[model samples]
Target chain A: MKREQGAARGLAQRMGIPGPMGGAHMELNGNREAVVEGCGGILEYSEESVRVRTGKLAVRFVGRGLRIKCLAADSLVVEGFFTGIEFLW
Target chain B: MLAGLARWLLGSVTFSVFPQGGRRGAGERFFSLAARSGASLWGVRRRGEAFSASVRAGQYAGLRAPARRAGVRLRVSRRNGLPFWLRACRRRKGLVAGGALAAALLLWMPSCIWSVNVAGVSGPQAQELLAQAELLGLFPGVPRGDIDPDLLQQSLMRRYPDAGWISVNTRGSVATITLSERVETPPVKESGRYYNVKAARAGQVVSIHATEGEAAVSPGDAVAEGQLLISGVWEDVYGASHLSHAAGEVLARTQRTAEAEVPLRQTIREPTGETVERRSLRVFSLQFPLTAVPAPQEGYSCTARVETLSFGGVSLPVSLYIERWEGFQEREVVLTEEEAAAQAWREIQAQTDAWEGVELLRAEERAAVQGGVYRLQVQYTGLENIAVESEIFTGGGDEMTGDSNVG
Candidate 1:
């Protein structure tokens, strides 16, 4: 009976976890952290911590030191910053 | 300080512009006029030392320097440039080259056949003279500069006595052999040996009128082939005196007999109407036929067949005139007396026409029957016995008298 119950649990765990091709559904379930640099009108990422910098007027500057959630069973948070010359709040 | 120095260098040049060569005479005047026109029209002036000065942007922008030291170098720039002829031919380079060619032609025109015209001569004589002249190389294309024309003419005259005159005329760059050849008559070649009148064809003599020879056969005399009808000499009954020979026609009735056993029933499919066509004729050097046939052969319709007779590049005085009797049936028929007489007379007349100028007497025809076929006999006698004559020329290209196939 114990062996039978252990096998059922293994199947449930496998079903819950997504493979490499699956998107952010397999994330921490709450807040995402990424920083990228905007250069020549493009926002691109860095490795240590994604840093986004709008070097020229090609794009708007976004994101400063916002911390993402790492606690809770499915904790998740989105951090975003955008500054357009013309404000559209 | 260096930039200031460059500035000073540039400023110094901008002030005073100098032209090296002094302008003089017509060529300089023309150059000045062209330059002035260019400047006035487009404000184009002296280009600076820089290569870019020739460009539109360089011309429009202020120059860094006033002028460069490039001077116009002349390649045979005549004090009066290329002669008036060249200057006049500003447009037609071909004409200039052609003029040079024409001048060379003027220099070179003394050679080639410009006008191979033969004047003062008519018919065959003119043509004969031209061939002789061509062989002599006295006509056009002969180098006029090298030869003494008068002496050349005299030599040619001696060679071709048939030519009344020959002259050379040069126009710009063309040489002409203006020839005037005299009309010539057929040479009468006298054999000097008097011949007896023998029967050319087998015939019976019906009548005789001896002109100069002794009549050997009387009227109604049957003479065999080659038997003498009249002897060239007369012999006395005693054979005492040897007499002189005479050159005259012996009138004797010579019968030319033609016998035929023609089939009687003949289906002669002849056309009811006839079509005749005539055309203009030319034989190179000569204009037309010297036979002097009046216009077209009218009355009895005939099919026209005109032919031009030419010998090499030289055209003859005579032409092949053929009367193509249209689609007429060449019917075979048993001829009656009248038809037979007409046919015989026509054949005899044709033979007579061959020697038209010579005096020949013709006799009335006689008819007879032999072997179920009637025979028609006609007779003729020559009035004047003419002898053929000829002379050998050195440069005429014809072989010497005894060397030709024709007698």
Candidate 2:
């Protein structure tokens, strides 16, 4: 499965298209709201931080009064005073 | 806001996910399983070891399998949506039935006329028109289908020959009737009848123009009341007598007199401060008094006010009538001489105004105070038409014997 993913990433780079395992696509509005697409699932949830797995990477959101405003199969919306975002592979 | 409304319409349930057997990460696993299973959730928050989130009510049941696989238990905390409200209403059947009945009544009430409004006239004429309209099945509470406006208009026009125009319009619960009275022309007398023109008032003959008769009195001739001014009998050129109707205009100078007397002391009814009020309800044609007090038969003046109920600009047949009766007491009022004179002159003026077609030439007024009464007398010389038609009774004689009749 690792070798197949690497081959797909190489093809995606040659074609100038974003690979599936690149990272979760995110949209941020000021510091108040965040929409993350390509969401695999929620890995961790708390009032101060939320970690979501997107394919091969995990996206962590750290904030005050953090909450998942909406959670669907492929996308999720997080709302709060967003302080930081990190990607861990 | 739109998402919230959509959730409300589709129904939603808030539930808490707790780990089974004290397993760690069970809440996270449950959320991930629910998301992968295509269930939408919102407002995810944590309270200690349990996590709560709202999911569509239909999708909540599907989460049971995901919860079991994730080693967690799902417990519904609250339900918010249309389905829950309907479920709660199922227990109280009376409220639903009452709401349905009220809706039906609102739809049906407007089909019947509740108010009959008459315009373009008032008083007894308006009352008579309403009575006639009621008799024609166009009254209050009558169904709109039962009243034909064209038929009602024709019936009312036939009833009042003097009405020039009539219109009936029904809108919602109000029926409006509009009408105009026709001006009637005076009837003309038959010319075949043998008639004589006589003095209606005692006055000197100023001028006479006989159109169909011989002059009985010349100018400057003094005439008395009921005296003949023009004769209907005249002689023809052939030595024969003929009787015909006389038509003429006789202008005469006439003396007119009017007198009025006012007493210095008069007994009048004065209103006492005490009053009584009574209420009654009128529904359609039936009236019921709400108050227990009996109406006063005498010495009390009553003023009535009517209030009709209306809904959404449609007047209802229900009316509340309030009558206020004030008591009157007999009191003697003393009038000053000047006041009495003023009142007497007012009466005299009213009388003079009633005498139509009289042109005043000279006038004199006499005022006297006698035996606790103020008397005002007015005398005037005026010119007016004095010829009035008087039927001639010839005693069944067809011919005359005098030379004056033969000319």
TM-score of chain B of each: 0.33, 0.54
Local lDDT at B161 for model 1: 70
lDDT of 2 at B360: 89
Q: Report the C-alpha displacement of residue B269, candidate 2, in angstroms.
A: 25
- Misplaced by over 4 Å in model 2 are A1-25, B1-5, B20-22, B110-113, B117-316, B320-407
Tens-place lDDT per residue, model 1, B23-80, is: 2222222222322223111111222311110111212122222122123221211111
- Model 1 chain B: weakest 10-residue lDDT segment is B49-58
Query: Looking at candidate 1, what is the lDDT of residue B144?
Result: 45
For all predicted structures, in order, the TM-scores are 0.29, 0.55
Residue lDDT tens for model 2, B1-407: 89889998889999998889989888988998899899999999888889999999999999999999999999999999999988888997998788889999899878888798888897777878988999999887788999999999999998887788999998877898999877677957675557788889999999999998898999999999888888888888997768888879999999999999999999999899879999999998679999999999888999887787877655578889899999999999999999999999899889989999999899899999999999988998999999998876554457433323212
Q: TM-scores for chain A, candidates in order?
A: 0.20, 0.76
Q: Where does model 2 sit among the CAPRI classes?
A: medium
DockQ of 2: 0.59
